[model samples]
Target: MSGAAIALEGVARTFPGGAQAVRPCALVVPQGEILGLLGPSGCGKTTLLRLIAGLERPDPGGRVLFDGRDVTRLPVEARHVGMVFQSYALFPNMTVAGNVGYGLRVRGVRRAEIAARVEEVLALCDASALASRRVDQLSGGQRQRVALARAVAVRPRVLLLDEPLSALDAALRERLRDELATLLRRFAITAVFVTHDQAEALAIADRVAVMRAGRIVQADTPRALYAAPADAWVARFVGGAADLGGVVSDGSLLLPGGRLPAPGPHAPRARFLVRPGGLDLADRSEATLVGAVTRATFLGDRLRVEIDGAAEGALVVDAAPDAAAAPGARVGLRLRPGGLIVVPEAEEAP
Candidate 1:
């Protein structure tokens, strides 16, 4: 499927009650690239996706363009954008092939053409073997595949997905998330997806536009967004980064665990964020700080330890899976230099 570039210029949305759902924003989505609209609930990510899909119009003076063609006033059908809802929204009574070909059939496409397109889409979505299965008999992942196949059957200019993987169980969601990314790449379709799942957005999107309180705070590649969030809130929300609560004085942080060099020039009380993996288990002699282990979970890959007395709140640290640190145990923390995320000191918010 060919992709279309999307541009939003000063786009804003207000409901009947004058509730500002989305603030004025400008964004550009390159052709064939996947952009993730990521934020918590009521953050306007969904509304933003709806505006792009033509389900909601931007307030006056706001313009939406597709490939430089004005499309702000176009209806949903006229825009030719595909959508995959959280529910999958498959027709339970119909067979997988029927659901996949429904849009083409309604558009007066010939039976042969519909069959050809259905077969092609089925193969692309890895649902070919289940072509004859009824939608009701399919699993959550299977239904998702059918929904994707149906969405792409008509060859849309852009594909919009709203929490596409939220319905499945944790394991299935993880597996299908990878499959979805691969499928989109194989189909070569431009896509904009809404997800509160940070890992999902980071793993799949070419770039992520992080929204907060109806405004876009930052938009960048996953690595950049995680490594260098625009603010403390963004840093916490994107990758579960925790604030290394301390007072900066004499070019170092006076953390309860120990003093560490805060390299940049700043006020005596500048704040910072660090990833869970950034801090390591250490001995008192080499420790950046010391804390009591409040909780510990050992997965095959790593041991996730939550510690107290390290910062103002619980600080999660990811250590080697084989490392043993049970709850109620004391652990030393070693902070890595590269893991420190520095933010501007002036704009302070809890």
Candidate 2:
């Protein structure tokens, strides 16, 4: 089914007792694009999704549009949006085919047409063989596919998923993530999914909107978001970059261990984000920092080395597996050019 473009203008959500769950936000989902709402729990990603789905009403002055048509007042049933939840909410009494055709049947569709559509969607989701299986008899992955087929069987204008892979184990989640990406593309449906897992969002979404507290802090393609975050929190949350405090002077940043070349002039005291891969063991003569290795762990393809007496306390680095540095060994660290991300330091509280 072709997808519809969705737009949210100044949408906000506030629950009873004066708790604001989502601040005023504006977003747009291109036709047939898969956008991911990413953030920690309590960050209002789900609330935003509910608003778009008409499961919850937004505060005043908010508008939701589908292909430029205002849908702010539309109820969930009237909006023609399909949704998949983390629970795989299927009817235990129904067979896989029954579950997939439930929406069509509820709308008084012809029996033969419903059957054909169910078979079509089941095949699309790679569940054609399980059409007659009972819900309880299916595996977790099978159940997930069934849920997806059911959501898409109705030819929804847009699809929404809330933590679709959160219930699966790590290995299964990884496997399903790739499958889900492929399915979303195959369906060519405008879809929005909520996820707290950064890897899942980055892997499955065409663009990711990173939320914080009650607002969307930044939204961009996965590669752009990883390469250049909007600020310190985005950097830390998106990729777990460590903030190393330092002083900027004469185009150099002076840290506890040593100084590295900086970009433009900034405040005397500044904070810099260093990704784990930014630091590497180098010859002493060309080193930018020196420290004693406190821990070394082999991570299959690479070695994770933690060092003390570096920037402030322990600094972690991803090194080549064959590097000789071990626990208690002193090593020189080379800072890769353009790896240091300067971010605004937090304001001091009065």
Instruction: Output the lDDT of residue 113, model 2.
Output: 100
Candidate 2 least-lDDT 10 residues: 341-350
**C-alpha lDDT of candidate 1 relative to the true structure:** 0.89
Top-TM-score candidate index: 2
- lDDT against the true structure, per candidate, is 0.89, 0.90
TM-score against truth, every candidate:
0.92, 0.94
Model 2 stretches astray by more than 4 angstroms: 265-270, 344-350
Candidate 1 residue-wise lDDT, 162-213, digit = tens: 9999999999999989999998889898999999999999999999999988
Positional deviation of 283 in candidate 1, in angstroms? 1.1
lDDT of 2 by residue, 134-184 (tens): 999998999999999999999999999999999888889999999999999
**Alpha-carbon shift of residue 309 in model 2 (angstroms):** 2.3
